[model samples]
Target: MLCRNCLRATRAAASRPAIPLLRAGISSVTRSATYTTSTQASVRHTLQTRLPALPTFRTYSTSSSESAAPPPEKPDYLNEAESTIWDRLVAEFEPTELVVQDISGGCGSMYGIEICSPKFAGKRMLAQQRMVNTCLGDLMTNWHGAQLKTRAP
Candidate 1:
């Protein structure tokens, strides 16, 4: 069965005959035909004409003037502390990618991470999350809190 809202929407849509504009796509044309429906009356509208095709996207060669910069190197302290923990966990359970985002305010201590790992494969959502928490272990004692997004590789 169709929902009441859906039926009302369909009736409203049918009542208005969408007028197409050449500048944009079907969406713009449809939006141009929009009208308010009164609670007291129910009536259908009809489209006056067919809409024109959507405008094609233009591509510019910005690369000709601009060059891509190399990614910044991971700092030594990051390698020593956070990277050490990551390396240990990755050694035990390899991952396709592990992203650590430090949100520790001015002091720079706490962090949030997004880990995409094959180790999480075949595991339930809660189990995957728990694995990350377990891997952090005692190190998390110093952290404010962590937000983790773990997905199967």
Candidate 2:
């Protein structure tokens, strides 16, 4: 025997109006309404109304207005004291390759250093780093942070 609830639901559905669907010169098929959920509509509205306009970026121009002056013969970041850090490393380790960068916007507060030296050959990574820190000595007090890379040549 058919369920009474199912029979009632079928009768109610038959009495309801049928929805129209988009047709490509063919028989129609039912489709859902176009309205979006509240969350989706809100996200779309925020993206359209609340977001700021995109910024315009310009490329470096070598025109006469822009000074082509040979980059000041040295980096503008390192002051005399900062430069001395690399100089001292060179004096003590005689590194094969050395690169030292003042990464604190020229304030001489932080450094990133890379050095390859025979002096570090037998040492563990921590020991090598300690050696460098020990060499910095008093200068370490003024530095905010340091990223050091050391290798045996």
Candidate 3:
């Protein structure tokens, strides 16, 4: 079954003759009128006559000439303990990416740490994590537990 729009297009094409070229060709002697749907014509008419008549828009693009966004600054929301841990890790690793969160209801007893650093390039996963833990040093003694993740950048 033809959709509402397809039905309309088929009807429109049937009622109006196709626009002939400037001059009939020799082949026109034996030519027959094949069926055509005016869906493209209807879409073009809609865009030309209706959409641009309104003030909002006519076209859009997925590209831009602008540069990429700047890097994120250190978070302002961290508490004292979280800040301390962030500083210690930053100094030791010079990481490309780092995140430290207190997952223990804001009491700062348990933390989740993720770090990516060039210093971890030749290390295994266990060794990378060990480096982070060793950098934390005496501070880890105060924590009940930690969830640590490390990656080579």
Best by lDDT: 3
Candidate 2's error at 108, in angstroms? 1.0
In order, the Cα lDDT scores of the candidates are 0.62, 0.69, 0.73
**RMSD to truth, every model:** 11.5, 17.6, 13.4
- What's the TM-score of each model vs. the native? 0.46, 0.48, 0.53
RMSD of 2: 17.6
- lDDT per residue for candidate 3 within 1-153, as digits (tens), equals 457875675566667776432222212211113553354444445545644354776676554334323223569998899989988888788777888899999887899998888789999999998998898979999999999988986
lDDT ranking, best first: 3, 2, 1
Error of 2 at 116 (Å): 0.6
lDDT of 3 at 2: 55
Rate residue 54 of model 2 by lDDT.
79
Per-residue lDDT of model 1, residues 1-153, tens digit only: 445974676576667776543332233434223444432122221221343456999986767225433323444556445676666566655666776666676353777777777678899989998998888878888777778888986
Candidate number with greatest TM-score: 3
**Residue-by-residue lDDT tens digits, candidate 2, 77-102:** 66687679877887777677778888
Task: Flag regions of model 3 displaced more than 4 Å.
Answer: 1-72
Off by over 4 Å in 2: 1-78
Answer with 1 or 3, whichever has the higher lDDT.
3
